[model samples]
Target: MQTTLMIYDGTAPADSGVPRTGGVPLAPAGFTWPICGSSCGGPLQFFAHLPVEDGVLSVFVCQNDPGACESWDATSGANRVYLFPREELQPVEAPATGVTLLPATSAIRTHVVTLDPAEDDDHDELAPDAYDLARSGWKREPEERFGKQREVLGSLGGSPSYLEDDRLPACPACTDTMEFAAHLEEGISAQSAMNLGGRLGYVFVCRACREGAFLTD
Candidate 1:
């Protein structure tokens, strides 16, 4: 299987239209900052600005009180994902009183990775997850294993890594199962990493409905 890995590409302009994490989101006019409805009742923190094939995926998660809010559940309202059109998108004005943005804006560059089938072994009964296999083999230098893993921002257009079938989200507009869109990692450093409770983040979308969902695992 092939997966497009999102590699960390250093700091970027906060409002640039590029695949990136931790930046002010670009949205259509009249779009207001999404507030965390599940808990904390404050604005959700902007997580990423991903430019996908058909549109941009703007993600937000509750940071005001991470543990207090159910950000890991797709329907919990503590997190949000917007599928906005590519044209006429402008930077949103963040709310002044809540955790609405990240400390830094980190750019991302795509690297297409192809994974070969796992060798026949006792564990071959179950098919290997492509994303997991690709991620594990990302580091080229054995000595820089852990350090190189940190450069992986996430991946695009691949199956969710280790996500359970039951956790897949349904489209709010049509109630249909959504397609997996991307996997997001915390980040390269503690100072800018998204506080995901040491978990991986997932994004899903329903193309026909032009809707999206967010969750963590």
Candidate 2:
């Protein structure tokens, strides 16, 4: 069965040139850089800094040795998602080199959508490069359902919070069940987008463990 979901997209903020890989938090005080998984033994790649009504959502991922580290496994300790309080938010220090932070702070509106075949069939069954396979048939259709809202994150709703349910990941830190944190799709352009391997990246966070996970499919 093909389940339909309404997702949203909006303009991204201008780049501030802060290197995201192993970058500091946006908060002015009382925050530290999130630790990458055991695979890297170093800092994770800063993905995005999304601001919402509640607070700022900071994201990080592991791009080092992506082809070898089971990078798509949510529990692989390759990703981190943090929801920081806006009151304590501040600018982060940029690094000298490497990929920098993504521009997504100004999420203005939402766009609702539904797919013809759910776009992710055969989800439970493991397939090589399953994430890419699931989205292979994607195309821009004129009939795409659109809506407007103030939602930034959590605007899209579905299994595992607007993503495929089977793609739900566990917390690598505690081996406990994880919860959906955000849904990352392609952006308007390359400079300010989440290049999620041409598929949707589902971000999960184990609030209990203070750990995060990421997967794309």
Candidate 3:
């Protein structure tokens, strides 16, 4: 797991002034800014710093994995970067003026893999944000479906990992608790090693009542 910081200038907004042609003023060394996700070969570079509504300028790290370690350093990082003028960053539709552009919604897609015990403790903390993004999708730039990570679930017969969408037996409609769905005789993904954390079992809502929780092996 890698961490990136979002730095926005607190100063006031102004018209397109002189282009600040240089690297960002600050960021952690070796942080990889994401232009897109690993699956899409993203976590791309920032063309340049962007100015926001209140004359605020902002910078952020790319969360994509393939471009994880890439940076804007003169020596180590790539030279070509992306920069969007304030006017260009404005809203396409009316009543939504003065909003900064983010990575395209499609570009923000990620797989927030939940972990079971003895897998990777370091990743558990990172699960929520990643999972939220994977399930609901992003709201900012490049409008598109963030989409579900249903593809990540795969099948239970071969792999040992389980996806929250598949394991958390909730009523698809109201999300009420469901009954026990089933336990796989074999592993699902690498994460099926533990019975806790919604792995090892399948839960479902009452066909009528529709309420459920996970039952692990």
Best-first order by lDDT? 1, 2, 3
- Model 3 local distance difference test score: 0.27
Question: What C-alpha lDDT, on a 0 to 100 scale, does residue 121 get in candidate 2?
Answer: 44
TM-score, per-candidate, Cα-based: 0.94, 0.58, 0.18
Error of model 3, residue 122, in angstroms: 36
- lDDT per residue as tens, model 2, 9-108: 3443344322121234576475655555646655566766555445556777765555645556665666667766667566666444434455443342
lDDT of 3 at 99: 17
Instruction: Write candidate 3's Cα lDDT for 50-116 as tens digits.
Output: 2222232322223233233332121123222222323434312111221122221100112223323
True-vs-predicted CA distance for residue 141, candidate 2, Å? 8.7
User: Model 1, which residues run further than 4 Å from truth?
Assistant: 119-126, 142-147
Q: Give the Cα error of residue 27 in candidate 3, in Å.
A: 22
User: Which ranges of candidate 2 are over 4 A from the true structure?
Assistant: 1-25, 28-30, 38-42, 51-55, 64-68, 103-108, 111-155, 161-167, 172-176, 206-211
lDDT of each: 0.89, 0.51, 0.27
Q: Count of backbone clashes for each model?
A: 0, 4, 36
Worst window of 10 by summed lDDT in candidate 3: 102-111
lDDT of 2: 0.51
Pairs clashing within candidate 2:
8-111, 20-46, 26-90, 158-162
lDDT of 1 by residue, 11-70 (tens): 999998988998799999999999999968999999999999899999999999869999
The model with the greater TM-score, 2 or 3, is: 2
